[model samples]
Target: MIQAAAAILKKEITQELRTKYALNTILAFTGATLLLILFTLRAHQMDPTPKSGLVWIIILFASMTGMTRSFVQEAEKKTWAFLQLHANATEVYLGKLIYNFLFLLLLHVFTFFFYLIMMDMAIQSHLYFMSAIIFGAASLASVTTLTSAMIAQADRKGALFSVLCIPLVVPLLLILTRVTRFALIEGAASGALNDLAALVGYCGVTITAGILLFDYIWND
Candidate 1:
């Protein structure tokens, strides 16, 4: 399983490096969204609540746009059948999950920096903020990866991806936004630990469920 996952991961990383399709699209969309927000709110001072909301909003949509390519590309290129011949469903899912998680972490980091720079948002607790980001990204990756696999053969993958992903990811986004808000406020650490725990639980559950169900989805 480990070797299979590693091989798949390497293949994915190499393909991504070669084409840069998902990476490029995510960066472009994120940049344009941030720029639009910057220009729209240039004169007004924005509060952290809405700023936090906006950050997750951008992440949600940007991730929806890029992460769907995980299995979609495979299906499009007819490589999914090749993978099924050589690899177990669990290995394929884990490999894709890892790739998506890493991709989302990088995307979030880049977007956060630009969001802070352009929107002038400040974090009071860097520790809590980074923790929220890590778990949040993981949760997003887990859910989207499974959903991508589930919808890979659908007629309208793009629309179905968003439709399926939104409800599944909403709970995670809510907890993440709350934790991030706590990270931003000076004295908002009261519930930070609890919220962080919730985020951790959410990530764990999503990944575990994906592991259990992915075989059925992939083979179906």
Candidate 2:
């Protein structure tokens, strides 16, 4: 299982390095969105609530753009059948999940840094805010990775991806936004524990569920 997963992960990383499809698309979209937000709100002061919400909003759409192609590319190139022949469902799913998680982590870090600089968003508790970002990215990656696999064979993958992901990710976004807002306020450490816990729990649940159900989704 480990070797199979590693092979798949290496294949994904190699393909991505060669083609740069997902990375280029995600970076371009993120840059355009950040520029729009910066120009649109240059004169106004955004409170923490709206600021935090906007950060996740950009992340949501950016992730949708990049991660939706996870399995769809395989299916489109007819390499999915090749993967199925060589790797078990669990191996494929785990490899994809790790790849997505790492990709999202990098994207989120880039987004957060630019968001802070472009939007002038300040943080009071850098530690807490970074924690929320980590768990939030994990949760998003887990859910979207599974959804990408499930919708690999769909005709309208982009539309269906958003339709399926939005409802599933609402709770995650809410928790992330709340925690991020808490992290922005001075001495608000006590309030973020619950939200952080919720984010962690959501990540755990989604990952476990994705692992358990991936075989069915893959083989279907």
CA lDDT of each prediction against the hidden true structure: 0.89, 0.88
Write candidate 2's Cα lDDT for 97-189 as tens digits: 889988999999899888887766678887778887888888998999999998999899999999999999999988988888887754366
Q: Candidate 1 residues 19-121, lDDT tens each?
A: 9999999999999988887888652267767777778988999999899999999889999899999999999999999999999999999998888877766
Runs in model 1 with CA error above 4 Å? Answer: 41-44
Candidate 2 residue spans exceeding 4 A from truth: none
Give the distance in Å from residue 135's predicted Cα in candidate 2 to where it truly belongs. 1.1
Task: In model 1, state the lDDT of residue 163.
Answer: 95
- What's the C-alpha lDDT at position 166 in model 2? 96
TM-score of 1: 0.96
Q: With candidate 1 superimposed using the best TM-score fit, by how many Å does residue 126's alpha carbon deviate from the native?
A: 2.1
